[model samples]
Target: HGEDDHGVHDGDGPIASDPSWCDVFAAAAKNVIAEVFAHAKTPVETRRQLQKNKMRREAARQTRRTKVVRQTTVTATRDVQLQNHDDHRVTKTVSGGASPFVSAASAMQ
Candidate 1:
């Protein structure tokens, strides 16, 4: 019973008993496993990309903060310079015989 040994039925014939069917199933299983691995890897890659974008955004925000601080410092320095200039003008006008109170009032304005 050579056919009985291979478990081949008369109705199904040689194609059903072929070893190639096992190979086909193995290949399909391998493909499915590969797809599963790829899907599993995707989130890790996406997380890394998200981290990089977050770092970039943080760096840009820090740069904007630094620029604003620098601008505020410059504006403050300019204000001090203008105040000094007005004080000097008030002193000169008082020395030139102008009334001290009027010079002080004009400088305040």
Candidate 2:
């Protein structure tokens, strides 16, 4: 820890190409690389845990899908609102151009 965190050295020590030095250098490189990749798994595991926590939090608020939903102010409104169970599509006009896959509403008629 006394030395610089980066690999760069100010030449306070001898710069040598000796085989033993190379061996030590290779081992240190391997250790640092392994440690970096080891920490890499932690973030991924944390994300998975966070997603599971969100799912559990949602489990408490969930009720029957057939129940009426009146909290439009809290949640975003589905493009199409269904009373019972039917899923409908409500087309919205984007002030911009449409996706290349779909034709414009004016063109369709």
Candidate 3:
């Protein structure tokens, strides 16, 4: 690729535009791609945050549900114990035992 007498290579006509057009076009393309990617990144970040919040809320609800279940179990156990204690007192009263209700009451206290 030898240059002609007019410094134009390959017998082509004189150049009309800037010689750095390729570099300028490449820089402009890179800028445009970066801007598009930046704009597209917002929704991804927002969706990630939303998913995290949703998981937190679900975990909170599950914890509350588990706590309620545990409390219910404790209450049921207490109720069964009280009913058995009452049954024992009635049996002792009818059978002439030395009144086990007093001991049960004292234990409860």
Candidate 4:
């Protein structure tokens, strides 16, 4: 058994909150943490597995974010293209309305 490390706050005393402690009653503490502090004994394999799981979760999160960003970008560009086409078509119609063909048709009314 060693001192506690959960508290990093230093007091007026000589570093009473040293995190370098590991205590292993059922197992060996030195195999977990080298610091002279109190910590639970964890298996190396278990720790590695937890790290890998975290990495996988992070990768999945990044992939989802990328997909959403890509979809949104594509949709926005498509909308812009549609709007541009609409603007051009409306301009052509408006310009043609002032021509003699449209005026002659209106004069027939």
lDDT of 4 at 98: 60
**Model 1 TM-score (2 dp):** 0.54
Query: How many Å off is the CA of 105 in candidate 3?
Result: 20
Weakest ten-residue segment in model 2 by summed lDDT:
84-93
TM-score of each: 0.54, 0.26, 0.49, 0.52
Which of candidates 2 and 3 is the stronger one according to TM-score? 3
lDDT for model 4? 0.66
Ranking by lDDT: 1, 3, 4, 2
Against the true structure, what is every candidate's RMSD? 24.9, 17.2, 24.2, 15.0
lDDT of 3 by residue, 1-109 (tens): 5444667655655544545776788899999999778767778787688679999999999999999999999999999999999878776775785456665755676
Clash count of each predicted structure? 0, 0, 0, 8
The reply for model 2, stretches above 4 Å from the true place, is 1-14, 43-109
Best by lDDT: 1
| lDDT of candidate 4 over 70-102, digit per residue (tens) | 999999999999999976765576577765655
Residue clash pairs of candidate 2: none
